[model samples]
Target: MARVALKGVRKDFGQTKVIHGVDLEVADGELVVIVGPSGCGKSTLLRMVAGLETVSAGEIAIDGRVVNQLEPKDRDIAMVFQNYALYPHMSVYDNMAYGLRNRGMAKDEIDRRVREAAKILELAALLERKPRQLSGGQRQRVAMGRAIVREPKAFLFDEPLSNLDAKLRVQMRVEIKKLQRQLGVTSLYVTHDQVEAMTLADRLVVMHAGIAEQIGTPLDLYARPASTFVGGFIGSPAMNFLPGHAENGTVEIGHGVSFALPGQAARGDVTVGIRPEHMTLNHGAGMATLPLKVDLLEPLGAETLVYGKLPDGLEVTARVHGETQVAIGSTLPFSVEPRHVHLFDKASGKRLP
Candidate 1:
């Protein structure tokens, strides 16, 4: 329903800078998720947009209005916190309607919004229950319902699903995605969970050490990371990095293992990146093969993860079919397509073309 923009936005606690200059534009109805590990300034960025933290520099605009000088309540945005911030003594209905009442909205209009949000969240039957009588998921829904009744210009979520158990987190993930799509409200979500970011975001901002490392679709970041840090952070099971030297159109990893480059690259020391899923058991013409000394196997129903070391003591991981049988201390051949290989500058860790 609104467009949110941050231009060179920054935050500093006295002389200690936490958020470096960050510029982002969230188009109306698009969900942009900021994902990174702890202490990466993700939550700080979200709080800046919500007016909970003062901007050290730069501008934040919501619906085309500058809000750096505005209070949180005047920004017309709703925030859902990690801890379900609901009054324990209030019924679910009253909790959802509290904001509207504070603004002196009509009693009937408040009732209409509350019931509508409850029905959409499937919390209609539990409206009369207090926060103490609800499950964690239900309490989260009540928090969301509270935000929904406000119908704010934008929605800000600060790891709203972090408190739930694994199974419940997945369920709530689905619900949150559906609700966002159904409402078409512009949303900015911050989470350390890459899986959640991949599933819920239209676009992802991969942050690290107060910088936005890469901003793109999930698959784009997976296939072409700009830096080794982005490469290691964006994917599950992570990409395997091998030290190698490149020259004359080839890279020699070590211990007689070398492969032809798919394209021209900087002819020097580089890190070769290969996703675990990109390696396979079968070799094809022009494919590079590595002899893996199997150290462990993790059978995950549909697939298994193979953890091993190369002849030079470089560790590697490969994902293979679940039924594939292998034993510890056994050596196996793993093949990698040259096109799937990623090359990064060893000194800088930036991707090399």
Candidate 2:
């Protein structure tokens, strides 16, 4: 396994620039995920690394060798695509062996690699099945198996799990993580799903509108987001952002609704953010409190999400365990854990302090 590096990578379509400039590094044998919304240049970046697309500027190196000008095959990387990209007429063994055969590898060597990959993926029993005969999850595994048999320098997955059902997606996610750990390959995964990025990545690279927002370990980025976009994108239900003022290390919303900032900051206008799970609906007196009017209630098995709005028209979401008989239009108190509150510069959308 080898490291993958991107130095000021850029891409453009005719006169329009899609990817500005991105600098990223995937350590040897590490699994890194490139995540963002649609058209954020994640797939474009991956294609550039795979040699499928030309780099408008800068360099892409795999295993310390510049591969920007190398052919896709010569780059020694295998890509698992969103659609599985398997041949409908070929059997599982045939699909996994096609690349090796093209390279003119010995027949016995090709058989050994294919059989080993099939065993690793638990597809040895289904090697005779065609693509149509296999389930979505199974077909996706075959695609991964095909990449595994190549023993390439690196692996690229372009939303490979997008076509599976939700339940199977969760299951296959675990399988992919396990396979990567066993193989210990340098991999770059591109996905729009934040959940997949969080659960599968050893580290995450958050992108927005082609720019890299932040790159760090999952916990580091989640705990200390470099920008408001990272805070809002990394967590589910999103972060609740309210525009307010910072006065003497505290943020003032309205009418005695003041929250202590995480650290010292100059007095100015700032956006206060707090996660739904970090805030609770409590009727106690402390710090800051907002009287909320419940609008909706979502019961998610182990927990319930209470959606409401404050008197100042600020929307709030609070997470509570078990089912609470909270009704709509009911005004109740809500408060956030002080340390859990996040402060950011309203103008730049960057974290403050």
Candidate 3:
């Protein structure tokens, strides 16, 4: 395993810049996930690290060695792509051994690596099966097995599980996490799904446009988002934003509700952010309360999601325990803890200090 570093990395297609000066470090044996909406350059960034794409500017280092001009095969990294680029005519065993064979390893050494990879992937029993005969998850494991056989300095995954069904995706997520830890290999994974990024990453890089908006542990990003884009993108049932003004140590949200600033003092127009899960039906006298008109209720067995609007017509969402009983069209009181409320500058959409 080795540390991966990107210093002011960038990519451009003619005059169009896709990756704009991203600097990041992945510790040896760390699994870092790059997540963002499509066209945010997450995939392009991963490809640059793999040496599959040219670095338009800046440096990419693996194990402290600059690899900007190395070929994909010479970079000592293996990439498992979204399409599971397997040989259709080859059996699982051959698929995993092809890379080693191409490197001119001894036949016995190739066989040994192939068998060990198959065992690690639980594909030993399916070694004779061709790509068409394997299930989606099994084929993805075969893709991973191919990477594992190389014993590369790092592993890169590009939406490797996107082809699976929802249930299979969840199962493979656990498998990938366990496999990465067991191998202790440095890894960089890219995905558009925030849920997958949250569940799998030791750390996350949230990208927007062509820039890395934030990079931190999942909980850190969730609790203290660096900007409004991160707060809205990292959490499910996205954080609710209310247009309001901050002045005189108080934030005046619509409906005449105001919250006292608990720490830093900022005055001017601001966007207030509160996660759905942080809003509750219970409130104390000091807390700010807002009246919500319930529009719909979605019960997911384990929890229920309430969709509603405030008196000022700002839409909001609240998550509650599954046992809570509520009806549509009813008025309910909702409150958020003072510390849970986030304020962002209205003009810049950046978190306020």
Candidate 4:
């Protein structure tokens, strides 16, 4: 329903700057997820858009209207928080209808909206039940129903599924995605869970230390990360970094361990990045091999994680088939393709050409 945009958005607490200048646009009916570790300013950035926090600088616009001076209620946005935030004494119907009632809406219209939302959320049967009588998933549905009835211009979600169990989290995640698509509301979601971010977002903003490290589709960040931090953060097992020197179209990771570069790289000290999944046990033509002294093994059904150290004492991990047999203290050769290797500037930690 509405386009939300932030231009040079920033935040400051006293003299400390917690959010650097961040600019983003959430297109109408698009879902943009902001993901990062804790203290990365993701939540703060969402709060600024919702008018829950003051914009120390920059501008926030909703539906082409500047709202830096507006209050949260005037922003025409609904927020779903991590905590359920339900009223224990009030039944589900009343909880969903409370906001409309306060706005002095006609009783009949309020009833219609509440019942419609309840039906969509599959909470019609639980409308009379109090929050205390509902399961965690049911309670979360009620919260979502309450927000849906508002018909706001945009929706803001702050780690909405964090408090649920693992299984419930997955279930709720699917439901949220479906509901958002059905409603077609522009949404900005903040979460520390990368899996959720990758699955739910149309686009993702990866933040770090109050700065947005990269903004792109999930697969784009995974395949062609803009920096070492992004290379290490977006993937499941995380990319491994090794100190190396690059010169003459080749990189020497350690003494007597080197690989030819697929393309030109910075001509001096560089960090070599390799994804665990990219390493294989088979020695193929044009593949470079590294001697790994196995230190630990984790068997994960379909795949096993081999944790070990290279001959130079640098730690590395490899994801291998579960059936592969190996033991501690044994040295196994792991091979990597030259094209799968990544290079970064050692001093700046930025990806190199």
Candidate 5:
């Protein structure tokens, strides 16, 4: 319902600075997810936008109006916390209607909004249940429904699905995506889970050490990371880093293994990054090949993960098809395409252009 913008946002506590000059904008009706590891200032940033935390510097605007001094209630935003924050004594219906009642809305209008939210969240029959009578997913839905009934200008979610089981988290993820799309509400979500962030976000803000490492669509960041940190953090199983010496058109690493650097001219000490999913057990003609001494194998039903070390004792991981058979302590050949290889500066850890 509103466009949210952050211009040079910075937060500090006494002498320590947590957020450092973050600039971001969320278009109206877009779902943007801010994802990072623990202690990365993601939740703190979200709290600042929700008016729960004061901004030490910089301006936060919602719907083209600066809300630097506005109270949480006056900001016209709804927040769904991680813990659900539901009352044990109130029924689901009363829980959803409590905010409206406090705002002096008519009883009939409160009922209409509450019922509409319940129907949308598939909680119509559970309206009479108390918080203790519901499951974790149900409680989460109640928390979301409470936020939806308010029809606020924007929604802020702080790791709302952290408490659910894996299956429930998957189910709730689909539900949340569908709900946000149906309502067309602008939302900003914070999560430490990279997979969850990749699945739910239209655009993702990857944060590190109180700074945004990269902000782009999930595919963009996955295909080409801006730095070594973003490259290692955004993917599952993480990207493998090999210290190599950059030559005129190639980087040599680990016991004479050299990969062709196409279209790059950075020649010096560099780090070569290759994703696990891109490593293939089958070697093709004219492809770069590395011999790996397999140390471990994890057969996940759909695919197998092979963990091994290169000739120079550098660790590497490869994802192979489910039917592939491999033995520990055996030497297996792995191939990688030249284009899938990523080059980064060894000194600064920044990706090479």
Candidate 6:
């Protein structure tokens, strides 16, 4: 395993820049995920690292060696793509050994590697089956097995589980995590799915408009988002944002409701961010408590989601531990997690203390 670093990396397509001077570091044996919306340059960045696309500018180092101009093969990395990309006629064993054979390894050595990888992937029984004979998850494992046989320095996955069904995707996620840990391989996984990134990454790199919004452990990003975009993007059902002001050592949310600031702030407009899970129904008078009406309720067994609008007409969401019985048109009092509230500069959308 090796540490990978990107220094001032940028990519451009003519006059339009897709990636703008991004720097990242992946520690040895770490499993990092790069995630963002489609066309946000996440895939382009991965391609640059794979030598499939030029860097346009900057340096990329793997294992302390500059690989700016190195070939993909010379980079010593294996990539599993969204599609299985398997040879239809090749048996599972042959698929896994194809790379080793191409490198002119001895036949016995190829057999040993293929057999070992098949066992790890639990594909030994299906080794004789062709690509079409296996299920979607099985084919994806074959793709991973192909990468494992060569014992590359690192592994790269490009939405490898996107083709599987929802249930299968969850199962493969655990499998991939276990396989990576077992091999102790440094990995970079890219996907548009937030759930995949949250469940699989040791560190999650959230990207937006060609820039990395934030990078941290899954819980770190969730608890302390670097910006408003990150706070809203990292959680399920997303965080709710309300326009307000920060002045007089207090934050005024809406309809005359004000809460004392955790720290000093500038006297100007700001955005308040509170996650659905960080909100609670309140019946007592409390600072920052706002009068809200429940517009809808979604029962989720363990918890319930409330969709409603604040008095000032901004969308808001709240989740309760048990299935809430609040009805539409019912007035309810609610408050945010005191320390969990996030403030952002309304003009820049950047986080504020």
lDDT of candidate 6 at residue 90, scale 0 to 100: 97
lDDT of 6: 0.88
Question: Would you list the rank order by lDDT, best first?
Answer: 3, 1, 5, 4, 2, 6
lDDT of 6 by residue, 230-261 (tens): 88889898998888788977888767888776
TM-score of each: 0.98, 0.97, 0.99, 0.96, 0.98, 0.97
Task: Assess each prediction's global lDDT (C-alpha) against the native.
Answer: 0.93, 0.91, 0.94, 0.92, 0.93, 0.88
List RMSD in Å for every model shown.
1.0, 1.4, 0.8, 1.3, 1.0, 1.4
Give per-residue CA lDDT, model 4, range 192-236, as digits (tens). Answer: 999999999999999999888999988888888889988988877
Candidate achieving higher lDDT, 1 or 2 = 1
- Is 2 or 5 the stronger prediction by TM-score? 5
Of 1 and 4, the candidate ahead on lDDT is 1
The residue ranges of model 4 lying beyond 4 angstroms of the native Cα positions read: none
Candidate 3 residue runs with Cα over 4 Å from true position = none
Candidate 2 yields a Cα-based lDDT of: 0.91
Give the lowest summed-lDDT range of ten residues in model 6. Answer: 282-291
Which ranges in model 1 have alpha carbons more than 4 Å from their true place? none
The segments of candidate 6 whose C-alpha lies over 4 angstroms from its true place after superposition are 282-286
CA-RMSD of model 2: 1.4
| Candidate that would win on lDDT | 3
Off by over 4 Å in 2: 282-286
Report the candidate with higher lDDT, 1 versus 3.
3
Q: For model 4, where is the 10-residue window of minimal lDDT?
A: 257-266
Candidate 4 yields a Cα-based lDDT of 0.92
* Weakest 10 consecutive residues of candidate 5 by summed lDDT: 254-263
Point out the higher-scoring one by TM-score: 2 or 3: 3
